[model samples]
Target: MFARSLPIISLLSIISLRSVSAVDYSETYVGCVSGTGTSGALASPNVNTISDCNYACADAGYTYAYFQYQSAGSYCSCKNVGPSASEITPAVSGNTNCGGAAAGVNALATDYYYNNCYNSPTAEDTTSQSTFDACFERCTTYTNAFVSPAGNVYSCVCSNTASTGTAQNCGVSGTYFAYAHTATSSPSIVERRKRRLSERLKREEQTRLNRFCPAGLEACVIPGLDDSFECIDTSSELESCGGCLYGSTGNSNASTGIDCSTLPGASFGGTTCSAGRCEISACKEGYNLVEGRCDWHV
Candidate 1:
């Protein structure tokens, strides 16, 4: 009798272990549930339904699971432990009856939702859909719960009506511009013009920097003016004008070089740098520069 009882106890222990190992498919919840880091976790792509999520978790030997809502579908995440009682929202339940419901026609402006991925191409819609209304309508046609007009394009994304997904943790402020959802709102003309102008200015600056100059010379912008730049020969421009005027020190005397004012006895006038050296291009009326000095001629 004692030996038979020992076998029965062992069998009971085996049954208990099996029960503990079984995955609980019904313990789903919202939020980014996890331990300190990714310690007992598995992620599954294209998990559209709860069953898919649970199956993926079970296959990966995890006991708990959750979904990440996105345009493509719900991505599944499997974990070893269920969310804490504090982490679970029992009142709000999963959409067991997703029912593939089409978007309603009477959707309100606030109902038009979107996730902020970033201010890059992911944030803006660069498509031909010109207005937020058009983009939202496109979303409704395909059961997409969110429409975003960012990056100057229209984008429609799938969403889980069950829960609001985690907001993106964009590091920068203001760069993450808001998405367009207004029915009457079209793409921002002002924004488009600003972008075009910025690109044009960049190109123009590059062209100026590439202007032809003698060897050892480079192009630079003039000081105090937008659109004013020149190829500079630092070795010869007036010592003050040497190098790029944009940032070169304007000191007139540097022992090795001389500004227009410090040219021997010649008065400051038409003086220019030819390669990396200075030359008197012209003289004031009634004055001629001779032997590094200016003389008045009758």
Candidate 2:
């Protein structure tokens, strides 16, 4: 009895495993489904046909390929998982025009193209449907995503209903049908632009601030003038020897050099500014040199 039970248990386990796993029809056409692009799946729009859609998915290494048609337009997307039962909206047709692996397709006025095997297209959309399509699936924000072709990657552009030319056939990378489905939430594309703009503004403001005085130099008002100033090295200025001779109000963290030659009681050529302070080498007969200053003799 124990031996018989073990065999039955093993067989049941095998059946369950087979039943639970989904089929891998990679590159093959299984069937279609319903709804818009797969929820949160990497998707593309304007793929030419289901055939191209299949290659697009396979090339992108997704488990399944999803092609959709609605009042807006046709779209293609790759997903690792098949659509939910609610999204299994099919449009059965006996037409095999696009060279699908199946004899007929499930195309309808509004369609959510899908397959049982689960992978989408891997190859480029031979149709003008690509370009705005890739590095392929990075732009899955709102449905109005467009692209600017650069080196090897794409500059995905984000837009909404407010953007112009929703009906116009795309003319940037190639001629292609257009689709529009504005989303209420902003995606990476818009967020990235905002962050970059903020960074640029901060940089510009810093540049303007530093223009008044270079890093090591100080901006000093030219004494009797209102709107004029001069750049002075505060660490060793002779006139503004120890610090700025006169400064209106400004950065609490800047050096202000003083004028050593302007000290009273010091004769010409008797006093000199060195380092950042006034030094008295010799004083007039009426004054005595004390420490570094020219003091009056008592």
Candidate 3:
């Protein structure tokens, strides 16, 4: 009798372990992300359903759980930063298998999940931004910017003049890690990240037809504008990788791509846009790729 019971118990244990990612979960739904993930991934779990994977992610003490459609619902991992996920990472929006906001977007083994950085203080020109590198990329046309990151939300404000805001607590009433621009030419190491988001919203419509794009191109909405968009070639765009989008937007914009150029501080030719991400052979200078966005040094 003891022998028979021991085998039964062992079999049950094996079955339980195998079901960790076998179905969908009822946890609050987050948005879908595309492109590859930044490092810090644990060995992924194997399951067969979105519900089951969501449960597994909760068990792992993460706020979000993501899986790939090609995995047939088995390959998945846990994350704490989600819902307000990585808009900085491009996407393949309209994927029904991902099981999140709107019709649904999809994820790849390389897809990323990130925390939301919010803008509490609110600037005159703000956009959905996550990392300092992303903010820097957005402000490529401006001389200054303000980045505010709050829980589950992130944003960057672009400006043409250097700001006195500095790295202060202005976004969320002291609940922010806000960075402000200090100079027109360069910034102090600390200010580099704060004012990094100075100019990236400037548009060049000389070669664009807003209502529609020529073949081999897609229309992407421009941030800080009203019903405005740009035509781009996802295959080679630095700002719209993979597909095309400003952030983790819905299919309404027609695309959900990441800004592959957000790998700020990258040495000339250090980072390249491949499909939908900023791929690099190695990190040069004071740069680190965290959660799919470049860290613009301290």
Candidate 4:
């Protein structure tokens, strides 16, 4: 009876040893990536059912994964998959069971090269406000076609072939985002022409104000006043200028007076010209000379 029992125990021991060896040994080969489909060692790449793929990587000690969809079927591998594993570096010619063994490898290599080579905990290229804004705009338009994954933020992965954009993980946290519209031109010439016209109108209005109003009174020109001028008194002019208008009024005690010295390129204590076209020399302090008239000091 002990002999029979000894055989049984020996068989059990062999089975146990095999299991331990399987667990201890590491297998390297070219296959598809698995879980998260993002970048970094944290992502899982075991090719299995989404759920199984999720756990297979953990069981296989891999954190990242991808699934290579091909004419035959899907295949999976861990982070260890490489050209040497299948005797086919990305440079090698001919086809192999590995998805990256064909001419298509160029595109796949681009994706893998960026995702695996530049793995970072922070968003890639998101160092400035402008970059963030541009990336955000692209993400908004492209939606999920590209992903910038949160933790593996160095590169973006394209979801489908229809997507014509790249993923940019902008930010310190490796946040994944998509950026489309590369190599695309800007608005058409007609659109630019319209924008230029609008800008020109603004400049014209500003030029008119500079020609007529006191130096600082440019801000006082109300919007849409194409050909209108208001005869503002000294106090009103001073308020518009944010201070007392520098210039002597013909009638110093007069409540209403125009100080031309406030105009540009005028000298202090210059001529004073009122709204009625009356002019006076030797104006009060803060006034300036402008075209033989005392302009308000700005």
Q: Which candidate is the best by TM-score?
A: 2
C-alpha lDDT (0 to 100) for residue 274 of candidate 4: 45
- Residues 118-158, model 4: lDDT tens digits: 12223322322222222322333222223332322213333
Q: Please provide, for model 2 over 1-298, each residue's C-alpha lDDT reduced to its tens digit, 9 standing for 90 to 100.
A: 0000011111111012211212112232323344445577656655656655554443333445666654355666666554332232223432112222211122111111221111111222222222322311332343443333223333334433223433321212321222233243324433443354344445444445447887766566565676666776666666776666676224322445555666767777776666667787877779887877778999
**TM-score of model 4 relative to the true fold?**
0.21
**TM-score: model 3 vs. ground truth:** 0.25
How well does candidate 4 score on lDDT at residue 196? 43
lDDT of 1 by residue, 170-251 (tens): 2122222123333332134223423443444455445445655555665555556655546656666675345554542222
Q: What does candidate 1 score on TM?
A: 0.21
> Which parts of model 3 have CA positions greater than 4 angstroms off?
1-26, 35-38, 71-73, 83-298
Tens digit of per-residue lDDT, candidate 3, span 1-298: 0000011111111023432222111232223445313135432534555554544444333434565544332355554444343342222322123333221212211111222222344456778765444564566555555554444445567665444333322222333322333234333432332222111111212223433677877766677776666778877777677776663222343446766554565565566677666575545578776665457678
What's the number of clashes in each of the models?
12, 36, 35, 47
Candidates ranked, most accurate by lDDT first = 3, 2, 1, 4
Which 10 consecutive residues of model 2 have the lowest summed lDDT?
1-10
